[model samples]
Target: MGARELTIVLLSAPTDCVDDDRTEQSLGLAYIASTLQAHGYSVEVIELTGLRSSELATALHRIPAVDVYGLTCYSTNYHSVRQIVTHLRSHHPGAYLCLGGPHPTALPTATLEDLQIDSVVVGDGELAFLSIVDALKRGRRILGAVGAIAPNDLDDLPFPNRHLVDQKTFTRTLNHCRTLSLISSRGCRHRCLHCNSVVMGGARKRVKFRSTGNIISEIRELKKMGYGALRFSDDNFADNPDLANLLSAIAKEDILYRVFSRLEQLEPATVQRLADSGCKLISVGLESLNPKNLRFLGKAGMLHCLKNLEHTERHGITVRASFMVGLPYDTDASIQHFFEKASRLPFTEYAIYALLPYPGTPLWENPERYGYEIVDADFTHYVQMGVGRQTAFVLKHTDPETGFTFHPADVLRWHCLAHDLFSSKRHMSNSQVG
Candidate 1:
């Protein structure tokens, strides 16, 4: 098999148009491709965002015969992955099919039950992907094996093969600068109940960073290629203390960028440093304002987060705060309180999504306990737009008193509408300022 030329194809599922306006490339799959290339495999990474299931089938039919096919998916994309697997089995029966990323890692047994997926690469796919390719070449067993790879060892992995991504598609979808999504680390240190990162990667919270020199070098290369800004896709940028140093180093090189952070992690000094370092925007996960809801969601540092919102805005960085509604304890009054608080905050952009219970999260593991009733089994509906659990609500009829009731879908839709309105307002304000 080593003597023969191998054509490996990596596929990302189509994005739901209702989710958001921003387009994101499959940076995770890109990392997998990079790893395979380092281990001597020829690979092609494809984005299925704009393609229908049938289109994907047709495209798979036209591609040159490949030795291996790798796919990435989240809970919202499981159905698409299943459909692709079925098509691949019917058309390219000889091609080895492997599944990775959040959904597969969370539901490995269920995924294997399909029989279309030859193997499931659990946790980080970098080392496992390379090992599978190598083993396949040697006619070794590679299915149903768990790769207990550590996140701290991420520095050993090669940078993502950006050349495989469609540059025009990325530019058009993101609708911003000519940018590349970069991951400086893996695994979140905080325990967000609804997040699957800890469940898949483990709770030890291992973090990795590209060396300061390495990051700067990559930025320089992108700058030479006429790229404008970078989208740092790390789960929590401020989780690492050296982030300031990294920002300083990039600033020294005059590199422009954007990044995501947990609101609680921001400090005035750090916010100022980030702005000074050419950061045009910062996204913060402001999941909820209700203290009980926040506690239920396992969010730490609620007060710090509120303060950080003000601090970041004062520093002149565009703050994009993401909020969630329709949790188990959410009430109409509580949600209204959230909206009022959000209006007063300095966040220039707002992303409001319904509480989605994905397969692997703690919430999904024990939904009944959280007063949530599972409604949809289809993975496509698992997108933030789909209503998951019928949340039991507790409301406050007056500001001084708290009351209780239940109406899940309505609560979810209200939050979605609020998000849309805020987003539209933010965009208009930005345009006006420009």
Candidate 2:
């Protein structure tokens, strides 16, 4: 078959949760789909989140026979992808199966061996995926890892294929406004031990920013599509050196948005400028409150985060503060201190999660050095919430200073408590806003 004559179905596997609101659109697959379509190939993007295995199977049966099936893999969705791959192999035995995304990118050889599938696309998928399609069309035997030649010019890539998804189903609703997600930059500036950014960016750490004009043009395109609000899905918004100019350009466009940034990135002046640019919310990862734990996680100190929270509050922008429980050095007192400090904070929203040592992260590679024992290496249990929230990974050492022995169940115990507190606080915050 010729490249243009081939049909490709790009899909994301089902997540543990059936909750639609919690899931975001798969922009990675959307970008890959767009890249494929631009080269004159027939492409279909499927969102399988919030579906049971049986339901997913039923949905897959509905899709017409295609030449290739590309599945986006992540640690949380590893098993789900396996289910889809199994069904495809049983039904469409002739189809070429491909896996991409973080999980496969991190462990391509394992994903290939464990799943017994055909080919894994590492790093960027656009150019590499095109190469895969072209090679397959030529009847070339492609196996193992398909090397990626990532686009150095972000402007050269096409906008994500948003048309494949239903806007109402895919877009996020924040503070009574419908918001769509977009990325203005690739990679992140920080080197947080648990972060997958560095791993996903390949060995050496780096950050790449799309030109301000390119980003503004995409925003205008989104606005024309009836989206009044947006969510910046960049790993770190403030990491861009031209942030001020970018914010100024977005201000003239008159669009409200939310962004994720390091706590240290927000200053009084930057907060004011963000508010002026119609920023309704700022999401900061205040991973830990304890200085010792902060140092271990390679995060900024608590003082900076607190100051940033105050600045956002002063600017009337809601701040969603996310915290991680069960760090390497965490103790009963330290965990309590985290919640106690969180209760007194000025942020409008709270998100609490257990620390999952995702593959390709420094923490995952050297868990023993950080006082953790990998009791469960199963990718399904690697998820932070829902189905497999409780897993085998546990703390192995007692805090020498506190003489507190950490139990296996303490991680889930602390996470549940923090989650309860977060839920109650969110309810109260919503009640007050209402």
Best by lDDT: 2
Residue-level lDDT for 422 in candidate 2: 60
Tell me the TM-score of model 2. 0.92
Candidate 2 residue spans exceeding 4 A from truth: 2-4, 387-404, 416-424, 427-434
Local distance difference test, each candidate: 0.69, 0.77
Error of 1 at 40 (Å): 2.0
The TM-score between candidate 1 and the true structure equals 0.88
Writing each residue's lDDT as its tens digit, candidate 2 over 1-434 gives: 55457888988887654233234778889889888888888798878776766677678787667889998988877877898898888888888899999888888888899886899988778889889898888877578888767788888889998899776665366556777889988888778888888767755356778999999999999989998688888888977889999989989998888898888889888898899998887878888888777888788565555767887988988887778877766766677777877778888776666677788887778877776666667756665444433333334555655666666588767776766556535621242221
Residue 7 error for model 2, in Å?
1.3
Clash counts for the predictions, in order: 1, 0
lDDT of 2: 0.77
For every candidate in turn, the CA RMSD to the true structure comes to 4.3, 2.8
- Per-residue lDDT over 1-434 for candidate 1, one digit per residue giving the tens place of the 0 to 100 score: 56577678998876443433225678788888888888777889878776654566666566556889888877766776777788788878888889888888888888889657778877888877888888878877477846645545556777777788766665321235566667777778776887877665644455566677777777776677677577787788777757778878877867567788887678788888888887777877777777777787888567455877777778777777767777656665667776776667777776666676777787677766665666665555655533222222221111123334355556656665555446434632232111
What is candidate 1's local distance difference test score?
A: 0.69
